[model samples]
Target: MPTGPKHQRFVFVEHNEEGQACGYEEDCRCMIGEDHDADASDESLNVNDAADIWLSKGMDEDYMFGFSEAQLRRAAGLS
Candidate 1:
């Protein structure tokens, strides 16, 4: 798992203009060059079982891709 504040936060997105999230760094680079709106959050975190649950609920369904809590848990193999 990532250590410290710098590595703790992570960005998760379902898709960008190109479709399904490829990577954050590349997306940020392309978008920044175009001067398009880009967002970041201190809320992103390195994955752990509990964090996975929180992430599912936190994803923005209307503005971004997000998985339901149950879906995240199942994907994490949590029974």
Candidate 2:
């Protein structure tokens, strides 16, 4: 069967001390949720990479959730 839209699989981005997106979350939550891994690497996210990921997931640029480009950049540590 064909999977629905990619946006339906929205992955949560874990933030670090500086409020930067570090890595992806498999089940919404981090260490407390299922599929949690304490040894997971906290890689920093880039603004361009984040934007591409959102676009690839079928999210409309103009109608994106409450998050703005600035926010994405800041959260990705690109700012």
Instruction: Tell me each candidate's TM-score.
Output: 0.23, 0.28
Cα lDDT of candidate 2 equals 0.50
The window of 10 residues in a row where model 1 has the poorest summed lDDT is: 1-10
- What TM-score would you give candidate 1 relative to the actual structure? 0.23
Candidate that scores best on TM-score = 2
- Candidate 1's C-alpha runs over 4 A off are 1-37, 46-65, 68-71
**Per-residue alpha-carbon lDDT of candidate 2 for residues 1-79, written as tens digits (9 for 90 to 100):** 4433222123555444454545443424232434344456677454455656666666567533435666555644557
User: What residue runs in model 2 are displaced by over 4 Å at the alpha carbon?
Assistant: 1-40, 60-79
lDDT of 1 by residue, 1-79 (tens): 3322222223544333222343353323331344332464646423343335465667434422254444444445664
TM-score of model number 2: 0.28
What do the candidate models score in CA lDDT, each in turn? 0.40, 0.50
Query: What lDDT score is found at residue 36 in candidate 2?
Result: 41
